[model samples]
Target: MTATTTPLLGQMMDVPLLVSSLIAHAARHHGNAQIVSRRIEGDVHRYTYRECEVRSKQLAQALIALGVEPGERIGTLAWNGYRHLEAYFGVTGFGAVCHTINPRLFPEQIAWIVNHADDRYILFDITFAALVDALAPQCPQVRGWIALCDESHRPAMRTPVLCYETLLAAQNGEFDWPLLDERSASNLCYTSGTTGNPKGALYTHRSAVLHAYGASLPDAMGLSARDAMLPVVPMFHVNAWGLPHAGPLNGTKLVLPGKDLDGKSLYELMEAEGVTCSAGVPTVWLGLLAYMREAGVKFSTLKRTVIGGSACPPAMLRTYEDDYGVQVIHAWGMTEMSPLGTLAKLNWEQAQRPPEAQRALLEKQGRVIFGVDMKIVGDDGRELPWDGVAFGDLYVRGPWIIDRYFRQESGTPLVDGWFPTGDVATIDPDGFLHITDRSKDVIKSGGEWISSIELENIAVAHPAIAEAACIACAHPRWTERPLIVAVKKPGAQVTREELLAFFEGKVVKWWLPDDAVFVDELPHTATGKLQKLKLREQFRHHVLPSALEVGDKCPLEPLDSDKGAASGATANTKSAATRG
Candidate 1:
């Protein structure tokens, strides 16, 4: 029974083949399990596993008839809905790559990604009609466009277009999904490119299947059929953390919050569908928490949630667990690594601790799952220890992880056999991973490093702050200094002096933000991480001199000098000393 004695390289399974097998299993054993979709037309659509399989087969056949080649890129600019789910399987199930375009990205960025990926067909939701119409003329390689909406919602277009439902209706459900090489490319995702132009990460069938398997394990996400799953995370980002596949594989009921992702709408859907589990970013949860607090709405059926795409603040995690009786699992990943690298669920021993202690442990990214090997290396290319005190750059290697960049083998950032994560973190004795900073985001001032993420986290913990970002700006004395930019909560008034005082007891006095700038809102990347580079550029010229520098530069003046008397400081004392 050993794999060494087995034949045919473990059956040469591909992602499409695995998906087809899972669909058949669901149809046979879980045929009545539900897939619910909230439509933009103010209607609710529902389907079962049996119906989904039949329609998915029809979609696959339709793609084949429309001249979709095995490796051609087919893009989708849709939301989380059943029709979008159909494209998820149909495109890749036919051995073509599904390129998910983020609708939130700038139009120019969208056009760049589409043209760079050479996407030949695009299936979009009707909500993006204006965006698609504007970009369609520039996408030369795209040959066909399909709207995921039905006849009633489908908008008229001048370009060559087809209706998604019409195409599915025209095709027969008798076609067989072709056998494909397991290593063949199956999906393409571009990085958010906050610092530079986005690069495509083409995932192979082998990588996707393995990643789906890893995501379903107990130590990883522990998803099961008993859990009613709702993926509020958009389909355009990292395959909604790969739950679209893991859910069906586990026979879980799926609730798709289509165009209406507002707090009231999501809470209502979860209650109606009896949803037990959901996944989204911290921003979405913040809105939901505010809505619930304001309306006194409750989710009796919701049991757990997974927060990702950015760090989950300890306050947000505590609110969900303590107030709503829900467990918030924090996860971290990028567009690469099939977008699932780390999760914040406690192990058995940690779960046995007190609630407050458990929350502290869960704040850090959890241990790496099986099939993933991780290490932190210093600037000297030396591997750091797992003591949790010493921070270094993180690196990972696994069966499902990417080994090279698509179409640019020489430009990839693979180190030895591992992929450089571009993140700075420390691993604790308990094997938990904590991200202190991104490699580029860490600030080196006076030869000491400062974690902007840590600063931003502390700043946002203030009650009056809605969001905060920290960046390094050029300083004449320290070489670089930390600048804090913050957005205030609605109807909250927090002056710079008061806000700076809030950080007094929490962090080192020197670590406090040199100067605080208030804005209505902070700019966020397409993937939800705060855009610090923009903040740095906006405040590069502002700087505060240190006490030593001020003392050295200014000599004592006469006590009777009018300049010192008017400035609120005695003539004998400099401004730096008085402020300190």
Candidate 2:
């Protein structure tokens, strides 16, 4: 029988899910688990979960003694180290938000972000001492600056700053985590600001906790106590894609690589620490692979790596699995969704398919886990079917997703309750997401869209090509055409015609780049993403030799190796094409 009265709630204790609980659990259950870090001071620091808990509590007491109030923002300009990890929990345990600032950003942007967040106290590593001094004048609202180092190593700066160790030593590890509303803001991470000024994504305690749980599942990161994980991604970037939280939640040993993300450094650390799983962007993996190839080395314990931030090249995937016996987990996400929406893990049916078929599915971003719901929409705002062909704008909605920017007060960026991801993509029937291109980076040639990512992937597949970027060059006839900007391997040589001919059968004829140009290197964002925006600007006035007049019918055909060869087209030398 249907009752007219309100439904009675279950008689379970309503426990608030908080970030502090994750670390507390780790300390209680896995107190001996190690947290290793290569410090910026050219040394290594090791601590256990039990010691980490004690120090984190001491740090909270120090923050309280310094008059930091609940809901206030505490900024950290440090790399991934024990001190930074302490701040991650310490600042949040007492309800203050931990604002991680990307040190790789321009100084002006760092100052602007600090001012925008109105940080109370900035705790920074010694490496950024000069940067902190330079930013002090621009950030008048900041209460004080604390160096994340011992007193002996503190640098001489124009502005006075406190020592993190000195402060923590004075506090006893008797402080208790305050009971905070689960919805209270826990961390703040600003976007990379590739377009305009960076907007902050203030993550709440509840969202962070939920994201940690979701990301640690078997189908996601597959994290557990048995693993020693290294997050090559910086802690400043979306809390290192929520690894800092998930690591503690599952009692996974964490190895923090500080300031030396070079191939040799990472290789040694992983081997010495017995790291089984790692995560980072494609550019970082490229460096590691190049080093491995040069040194003829192999991982002893590393079993997998999660590649995100940008698309992982299919060639790179094959190299990892075939050459090195390491599985590459392709992931996709943004800062707004706590940076982990989908992780590439094959399902039972997909795993049972042929290896080639499985590889094809693995090439695409995996299906959503339990928390996230995604859909693709056409230009008319109509939902598109997941047929793997109808590409459209991608949208997502989930509990951990952002409802609005940190301080944005006006209209919402959400379209009909879903956050537009600013990505052009298609979803297969089995729910794999194939991101064609970023909305702004997609090439519009003759009213047709060309996937720059696909073109770049094929270009990088060439053995001689070290990296590649595909950008739109203005074409008088078709409005725009594709151009390949490539970087060749050191001492390797290939002609422009030879490179252009490599794409003959891989894609449609028209999708072939109109021209190829060799450069020393392509520009990258602070987070190791291809800076196509800068490339487009640099080549905006570049003239394509194959461009036709307004009324001319452009030939859409594969390159004829002999006919398409430009004079002195050797890739050993940089392109002599005229710049604007």
Candidate 3:
């Protein structure tokens, strides 16, 4: 007798999880909720979900009239405002792929990405009219240029442009959104292309829906109808970390700041909108903290924030948690995993621990979420133990993880079914992950690898230090040593000896940088990580002090510091993991 298969007793409905459904749910169930945007025209734009639904239909009709077909890529070169949000729903709902181009990229990169995507219609804000004109010749595949403005603000450009309002006005009142398969691609976002040519991360409707659902859970971002959300992260960068979709799914009010992500602008918008939660990188928060300190203001409404894109300094974390009574969740992800692999929200048991212990736990990248799984592997492809001491290359597998780059560029970026995240990290027994350094950025000094990230994090905790980065520089004996590039707070100064003294006990003597050099400002990637490759090149032939050799007295006498006393705790404390 053959083995029999079992089936469910009740028949279940199989409605596809399309991007259109998110907006539809908002329009029908939470029709009156507000989606506010600070427009580029120096005015706040407000619209209800019901209004957004109707206008999105009109824009879809416009796309159809312009001969856009399902699966074709549509480009958006605009800021984080109402128009961009409309473009998102319009392009994706009409069955076309929405490709959001980062305007902050170099012209060469911008042109290359738009051309590579083979975008049919490039919808751009008025601010980018000049850029579009410059890029029009290179991107000949763009059939039409739709300026995201009215007839009054229309720009004269080399390519014939259509006014956004006029195009929408000409379209009929409504459009019938097709029932696309859940697996169809809905959004396309390319990486910053720091090392090589940028690769696109094509997200499907199914993956995006699941990502939003996972992000909205109580343990993840905890988005709900009662919270007002401000996503300072750009819409072009990883789809603003998926907040746009998550907001609608949970009926959360959204406040989108256009091109004005500066300190004053963000603070005003957050205060006026009563924003309860926000997400951005640490650098952005640094500016906000400075502005708040000078202006003598506090975040009256913001209760929590999520910091990602790079490691968050412990001092910055402390300011929000200690001074303002706001919770900080350290998130770690890349563009590959729908940008949310792990979020460092405290568990109940961990929450019961002391503040110092909690800070130590929060320093590491948080535990993995439900949809994602991770593992550490050594050179021999053997799985490493999660004893928190043995650091290895991090690999991740998940429903939303990319199996291959778009257009098969650098085809199949997976190793035995897992994507290799280039960062070196350790997994604690309790499942927390501490990212030590990027494989490229790790410094090898006298046969020992020093984590540049860990050093930089410790350096920035000093009261006078504003920003810091560690780069590997040439040395006579060691071959490579950690070199520090630090920026001081305005009107503040500190000696190199004083700064290095704080790191004496942080790690072994060799781990500290040989010298500290102050700079006005450090370079940053488009997505806000420090541009270390350029720094490495600048100091490649740097000469070290004559006296310092492979083995010498610790740079400076040990001084008291929180990170110094608790240094190497993550690596030294080894315990067994409860999970396999």
lDDT of 1 by residue, 1-580 (tens): 4457555656653344444556667767889998899976678999998788888889889888998888899999999988888877788877889889899999998999899999989999888888899889989889988998677677977666788889998987876766777778888888887755788888877777778788889877788878889998988998898888888888889999997878998999999999999999988898899899999988889998989888888777887888999988888887778888888877788889997888777988887777788999999989999998889999998877777766787776888877999999999988888898988778777788887877888888889888888877555566566767788888888887788788788877667777677776777887677776555444443444542354434322211212322344322212211221
lDDT ranking from best to worst? 2, 3, 1
lDDT of 3 by residue, 452-540 (tens): 98999889998888999998766656767787778889988788788888788988887978877777788898889899866654444
Off by over 4 Å in 3: 4-10, 546-580
Writing each residue's lDDT as its tens digit, candidate 2 over 467-537 gives 99998877777777899989999998988888999999999999999888888788898999999876765
TM-scores of the candidates are 0.90, 0.95, 0.93
Give the higher-lDDT candidate: 2 or 3.
Answer: 2
By TM-score, the better pick of 1 and 2 is 2
| Model 1 TM | 0.90
For model 3 the TM-score comes to: 0.93
Q: Of the candidates shown, which would achieve the greatest lDDT relative to the real structure?
A: 2
Question: Candidates' lDDT values, in order?
Answer: 0.80, 0.91, 0.85
* Number of clashes recorded per candidate: 0, 0, 0
